[model samples]
Target: MADTGLASERPLRSASFRWFLGGQSISLLGSAMSPVALAFAVLEATGSAAWLAAVTTAALVPMVAALLLGGGVADRHRRDSVLRLTSVGAGLTQAGVACVLLTHQHPAFLLPLCAFSGVFQGLTKPALRGIVANLAAGRGIQRASSLLASVRNTTKIIGPTTAGLLTASVGGGWAIAADAVSFLLAAVCFARMSLPDRPQRTADDPTMLGALREGWGYFSSQPWIWAVTLAFAVNNGFNLGVWQILGPVVANGTIGARGWGLVLSARGAGALLASVVMVKLTVRRPMGPALASMSLAAVPLILLGAGADTLWLAAASFVAGVATEFFTVVWETVNTTHIPERLLSRVGAHDEFWSFVPIPVSQLSTPFLAAAFGTASVAVLGGATAAVAMLLPLLVPALRRIEIHRQGE
Candidate 1:
């Protein structure tokens, strides 16, 4: 393992990081409601799986395009302002979706609005990373990232369930309104933040594309970065594309959409619990032992693979949520701390690309997988892939020895 100069204390001095995290937590809560409201709205209107998939694909398109470019821009600009712009744009887009649903009553209009939200979200990606890297710089990186991950998972606990109830009782229109309002609330929280300054750029700096190439170059040199990315890409397709989509669909039919919400909420609960404990439990800088333990945590797959009775399914989702949260918090924290900020976006993008690259593929392929192998079997295969794929990065010597380290203390 690379020498990380182990220190026992956290990085931040005041409660600012906590406040920052809370603001984001609010934003994520709203974001969590969005997919459910949008999905149900479209499904209610069109009743076509093909159209559902189409809208999903369209929504994500901007994310794939803008993420890399956004990272470069973040390096060049005031990350806080960039974040503010995106948050407002994202919120307005949600409001637009609500207005269209309530007033015009059109699925066609809603799709474009959702896509616009996705585009703004794409712009926020790099700024979010920059803020995280900055706030968590030094000792607190792991805990901060872990808390943030927990916050995101925590949103699933509240957002989806609330959306489901609103849709069930009031109509998708009201759920849309709540989501839009949530964004405004989230914007207020972000507006109050005071992040430290970004690294100043000289007048002769390279273009965004050139900066992108530089970022890519840094990542490519690290076998761990690319290898881990590829591995996650495989797992993500199965994890994000297959499990996320099919899990809810299956749960909705078997347990009820409300039940689906509970299952997802269970995941959030498990993640929330694990992160609370992990915040105090320092990482094993040497990857071998803890990585082995993280690998074993994948045992929940057996539970997830078999079709669930309502109770069993929720339990499995909760279990899987805890295990996945543990893995992600540890991995993300380590990655953020160890990689330099300039190169961080590329590394993040590298891992994220693989993590997300498969989503579209899996989303496209999942129906076929379900038809051929059965939903249970498809889920089983995805779980198995997630369980086994953790070893891919370990195969590279550099990653096995990678430890969380900030450049300057």
Candidate 2:
């Protein structure tokens, strides 16, 4: 295996990777800011949890629907081109959202705008994963994943706090505007990036539908992949749904928006710390540790359900961040290393599609569930469900036995 020290530095040596990382860093900063900004904007304007759920659900549903098409397009075309185009589209839609929010906080206008952005997001998601796999191929996928996670986590730390301050002082529209600018800047960076040449597709190449089916066949054939994806389908509905939709609502009553931002920032801080550790850490049996760490995701949800104070909530979020980041780096590395490069994007899309399918349901249902069962009860139940779901994949022998070997191993 490549020496841990050398492996960590190798991905950075590539100029293309550098550009990719730089663009993603700037873009993630804005994206990190966006949820906080958008959540508060919707909540403050509508003052209805259901409305907030509706607006957020609008974005997620289309993204989930578009994943397979986007994945096929990404695998067939130059991944960088897909990224650049999608970034531009997302930027434009986000700008429209900012403009509407600034002029009049209208849910009617926001729904379609957010849905458009989500389509761009669907197009962008698989391409983003494929590009990293391409850029960092044969040069420490784990390190590359860690670096990306580090930047993302770092931005989360800064973005939410900034969004909170902006939302509190100038209004959420400006913060959303900042996110739009970042997307444009990222598009510019993506345009300039150069990737290794992909094999030209031939007339014999499968049609998009055929290709998607093939991808699904491979994805479902892999017990490890399908099992984990299935688990996340259930887990995300609980973890992300509660955290994103109900989190702000709970905070609105208790910790306030600014405090909520801080709690998220604390989670970012923990993830950033984990990213640093992952750069040096080596795991032969990655799946076990990955899923084990993922179970920690339940902590903050449980805490939030219990109406923990700001300090306690932040602390729990921090721990969850660490766990989540560890899982992310391991998961990305395993996929990149094990999957064929040509099929990676489509497979990734399938993985993402299944994993995220439940998110919209969670977002749409949580508000009503909370209304009926009470937010705290729902949250605790969600956390318990997430914890159990995260561990169930461990029972799959293929997943438990999966191991990775670095270069020279």
Candidate 3:
């Protein structure tokens, strides 16, 4: 089977998987464009960060609320169908936003429309994560994950640049409309892909609340999962959420606007390189390396805190991106291989919730923290805390002793 390239391990050989990759690549590129476009739109509409924050909050709250239920729904139906439906729903909401802005309608509609978009986006998360297992044909899940990561990293570079160009040349409405088009294309691809339906719910099976409880129970039973999830809640909150706010502030002041752009470009390049490297490198023991790779990400935060020259900061950022991507591939591979397919999406949603719940808090709190401790101090503290938090998971024997490949075991 391997020789004929029809083996389950050969994900690239499957036409449906190729289409899946193409659709996801385009979809992620659009998602990447949206932030820059939306930020500009809100600012143009109201000229206030307060209004922008309100719009963002409206989107995030519903997305978080819907995650667990979305996971349940993914397990109850065909994952491909869910992906297609959510893509259509989300595309319509984005189109509505584009239309409202084009006609110069009252900004009030933007809030609800953004919230509606978030609902569909939230519904897609579990299905998105779980679909790779179905696509992998019982093998090559890790390869598929690496391929997806590579596409995403490449798009992160292209999306923002395209968004900036479109928003400046035309308008934010047009840029958002482009995103809507991408979603429609994604829906078309999902519609074409084939996947098996999930098991029908039986009388003995859990209700939604019970399913949530079962997922939580599975998570709690695994010390590694819980430890890592708790650690990442803190790490992501500071490294990602707080940085999303304050990093730009610090970069604009220290490195200047052009320099900050260069730093981001370098980080994206590094992530692309990591994805390419992981194509061949298999992790036998993933846990220790995954934790260590994540800890390395703190160095860039510390570098920024020190107000290093742009060159130094860019180099650190590049390294941090590489480590972060490496950690991501390893983490996803472990989950896909180890978790039961029937419960994978629900458990994944719980994991996603824990990782994201702190993000909003961090975003809201960053300004206050910076005001209280000063920006440099906040960066230093956040970086130190992230390193400590990630490493704490290593204290668990299960985490340190685990091997991912499992062939010998």
Alpha carbon lDDT of each predicted model: 0.68, 0.88, 0.79
- Residues forming the 10-long window of minimal summed lDDT in candidate 2: 1-10
Model 3 — TM-score against the truth? 0.89
Best by lDDT: 2
Cα lDDT tens digits for candidate 3, 1-409: 1122452477787776777888898788888777767766666677654455567767876887888888888877889899899999998999998898778787788989999998897799988878888877434777888888899889866776676667666767887888899999999998887776577778999888888788888977998788888999989877776666666566534554345556665676788899888877887887898898888888878878777887887798788879889988888888888888878888888888888887777767776788789878988888888888888889999888776673234
Q: How close is candidate 1 to the true structure, as a TM-score?
A: 0.87
**For residues 16-104, what per-residue lDDT tens digits would candidate 2 score against the true structure?**
77778988988999999999988998888989999989989899999999998889999989898888899898889999999998997
CA deviation > 4 Å runs, candidate 2 = 1-9
Per-model TM-score versus the true fold: 0.87, 0.97, 0.89
Better of 2 and 3 by TM-score: 2
Tens digits of per-residue lDDT for model 1, 274-345: 787777676556454444444443444445557657677667667766766776777777667667876666
Global lDDT of model 2: 0.88
Look at candidate 3 and give me any clashing residue pairs: none
Q: How many residue pairs clash in each candidate?
A: 2, 3, 0
